[model samples]
Every structure is written in C-alpha cells, then in structure tokens.
Target: MPAQPIHTNRLILIPFTLKITKTLMAGDIGILQKLGLQLTPYWPDQEAIDTFPKIIHNLEKVTEPTGFESYMVVHRNSMSVIGDAGFKGLPNDDGEVDIGYAIITQAQKNGYGLEVAKGLASWAFKQPSVKAITARCLLDNKPSARVLEKLGMQQVSTDVELIRWKMMNPAHEQDTIDC
Candidate 1:
C-alpha cells in the first residue's frame, strides 16, 4: 500500500489503487476524486494511453513483490494529469528496482519529469527493503537522461540501445560506508 500522497515542489504523486486503476481503464476519470484522490480528472499521456491496457492486464494476473505500482503525477496548481511515473517491479534481492515515466508532450520540458522521479524515488527509499532505484532510457532520450541525472542517479551502465542509471538510498549508502 502507498502513503497518503507523495508530494513534490510542483506535483502530487497519487498511487493508483486497484479501484482507481480499474476505474481509469473503464474510461471514467470522475470516480477518482471520490476515491480520495485530490486532483482533477486524469488525462493519460500518449504512453500511458497506449500501455495502460497491458498494465491493467499484468496487475490482474501477477503479484508484485512490493513498491511497484503506477502513480499519477498531478500538477499542483492545475490539479491535472501532467504525466505518469512508476517502478517496473519491487526491489530485487539486491534491493534494486527499475523505474519508468513519461509526460504528455505538451507538459514536457517544464521540470515535471524530474519532480516525479524525485518524488517516486523518495517514496521508494522510505521502504526499508528498497536500497536503490534504477532507470533506463534510450540513448536518444536526452530529456529523460537529464531527469535521471538531475535526480542524482549516476550512469551505472550502458549498452548500444540504452543507458542505465541508479541512485542508492542516501541513508542506506551512509550505513554501508560507515561499516
């Protein structure tokens, strides 16, 4: 389960509960407000629009370890869906989890991406089992690379097709270094 709501400088990260995700998949955004989500109706990004069906399908068929769930990024002032961000799955045995996010084209470049990443990573770090958050982006996705970099995630590995970034929980890192 997620906390009340993960807040950032310009956005609110609302975890998508089963009811909310199901409602969203059913094409009714109005139900969200009544579900305790304090925001305007949702408007999924092109990516969210395209991938939500699969997301719903997977959520129904599988059980995630923990800390992996979709979150809606609502613009604080406008109370609107600026984009979405989430972990690919719960942290692994090594305490690493992959993350993914995207903003609607219109909302791009306004620092929302970094804000969402920061908010999500902060939330994940609150889970004692989560040690680090990781993300991968296509080499051409400079904006995403910038978001990860701005969130203090280092470029840990790269391949011809993508660059991988990771940021360990600061407290956990300090504990390790102090050992």
Candidate 2:
C-alpha cells in the first residue's frame, strides 16, 4: 500500500522520503517545499542529521506491509516542517514499538510535539498487531516527558540519564492513561 499520510487538526505526518533525506544531508533544506513545509533554519539539527542514515535504513527495512516509520511533522497553517516523529520500527512479537520525535527549539512548548504524538500514537494503535508504544527522553527534557504524560503514557522505568514511558493499548490493557 502507498504511504498513508497521518493528519491532525494542524499537522501532517508523512514518512521521510529518500530524495528529501538526501536533500537534507546536502543542507538544501529548501527542498521541503515539496511537502509545503517552510522549516526554520534550526531544522536538520545535528542529532537528526547524524541519525538520518539509521532512520533511512529502518524505513528501507520495514517488515510489515503497513506500519510506522519516522515522519516529518509539517504544520498545515504555516506550511513549515516543525519536527520529526513516528515509531522507530516495526512492532515486536509482543506487539510493542518504540517512538521517537522532536520539535525545533524555536517551536518547543507550543504543543506541536503533543499533537504529533497524539496523532501518531493513535494511528499506530489502530494499525494491525500494535499493542503498545514506548518512548524515552532525557532526564532534563521535562517538556518531552509531559508530552508522553498527556498522551496517556505512564512512567515505566528510569536510568541515570533518561526516563522511559509506555502506554498500552486501552483495548488490550486494564490500566488506563489520563490523556
């Protein structure tokens, strides 16, 4: 099936295409115009760029016919790419998958991350065989943790540098999330 772009009230989440990924690598971010996104100069941050190869590889290696892949978060009204999000890969045998997302520092705290997570997580839960979604954030990233909390995710674990959160599919788990 063709990639079915996920949509929200103000954002569109679509997978990162190879062509655009190449453009991003070349630092010609203007190419996002193809997606109607006018991203801020702060985009293509070092971390996102550094991880592009692995993300591209994950996109190429998806086992399911239809499931999650990293997505560029495009703001509908401003037509700017605000961030990247979506599941990290296919669901495991136990029906769990990890999620990764980020918004520009300039756009942080404006709720784009929450909206993207809400849309992507709901979409993932609706897909075949998905039972839960997990996320991790640096200990200092309170805003990111709040996005998870608002998404009905509960703190499941923590380590020296990061905290882990997870939300089981309400259809399958007895526990409820506040979202």
Q: What TM-scores do the predictions have? A: 0.82, 0.88
Give the winner by lDDT. 2
Q: Residue 71 of candidate 1: its Cα lDDT?
A: 75
**Residues 122-144 of candidate 1: C-alpha lDDT, one tens digit per residue:** 88888888888989999999999
Error of 1 at 127 (Å): 1.5
TM-score of 1: 0.82
In TM-score terms, which candidate is top?
Answer: 2
Q: Candidate 1: which pairs clash?
A: none
Give one digit per residue, the lDDT tens place, for model 2 in 97-154.
8998888777787889999999988888887678899999999988898899999999
- In model 2, where is the ten-residue run with the lowest total lDDT? 59-68
Candidate 2 global TM-score: 0.88
